[model samples]
Target: MKYLEWRINGFLEAVNFCRFFDLGYNGNRFTWERCRNTQNWVLERLNRALATRDWQNNFPNAKVFPVESASSDHAGIFLTLGVNVICYAAKPFWFENFWMKEIDIKQAVQTTWEHGKGQPIAEMIKSCVAYLLEWGKNKKQQFKAKLKQAKAQMTRYRNSSNPYHLQSFNSAKEAHLQALEQQNIYWKQRAKQHG
Candidate 1:
């Protein structure tokens, strides 16, 4: 109970620090439950939607309610902005910054652009985009295959007692880490573009 209180206090402090107010919910009061139909069953209002004053003013009629789910222990919160939602069409082309790190990208682009000579600027752009998209797709597939193989090797060598196996495991582990770091950078660049 003391630990729970401490956590609650910390949450409250954070909320206050952010100047966020809870958007009161409707429907089932408890958002989570466990040990259903047993003596140890517990229910808790663990989930909530919060917003700042500016947001509240912008969408004064926003509403939040809990939706019970049969497949999960926690209820999903549904929020309505109480206004018409505008759906924007996705952009046709997005150049990933992470692609710049690839050694072949510059050469690939140069070759593609060279082939686009004597065409309109727009046509050249379209051709370059098509080539880049295909190139990016191939790179992504290769990375995934490399990562999978590294993971398999790491697992195979994980429990071996031989020093050679240990060295192989370490090499596989390093390859796996490098692949993951590259993937992380790719996603981070993508998130920045979208966000």
Candidate 2:
């Protein structure tokens, strides 16, 4: 029980820190690999708590979602950090289906491989790698471009002295976020890849 409380507290602190301070342990091994060996300790602690089913009322804001386990004895976890109750929104799966392409995606992958003619093995591999790289880059750019536009529109509110206009921009941003949330399936498909 004490351990669960500790885990919940750690989870809340980690999210709050990221939302405001951008400093906290991220248990993602890849992230740790890039910098100092900083583990996502906070997340790890929360996962441990769930495994024990030791939860209490000490945490009002912390959310714990059950995970579906295909083989493991314990379910996995879905954590929401830096979420705002005032703005309250459904959590999102960072991965999207749009990323998933049916065998049709093989068109992109195969086209890249098939074009490997006079090129050496290494060169052929590089060409295919470049194709996949550019595909990912294009997807990132598309979303970034849209987010940039929204930020620019919000900036216009700073120039206005009227409180009404300021509130208008705030609402506009909320609406923009909602639009993005509704399109989660679009992202899921974009992210899905059978190829």
Give the whole-model CA lDDT for all candidates, comma-separated: 0.81, 0.50
Candidate 1: tens digits of C-alpha lDDT, residues 36-97? 43568788998889999999999999999775442466767989999986789875777866
lDDT of 1 at 171: 93
> Top model by lDDT, which number?
1
The TM-scores, one per candidate, come to: 0.52, 0.26
Error of 1 at 74 (Å): 27
Measured on C-alpha atoms, candidate 1 has an lDDT of 0.81
Model 1 off-target regions past 4 Å?
A: 1-91
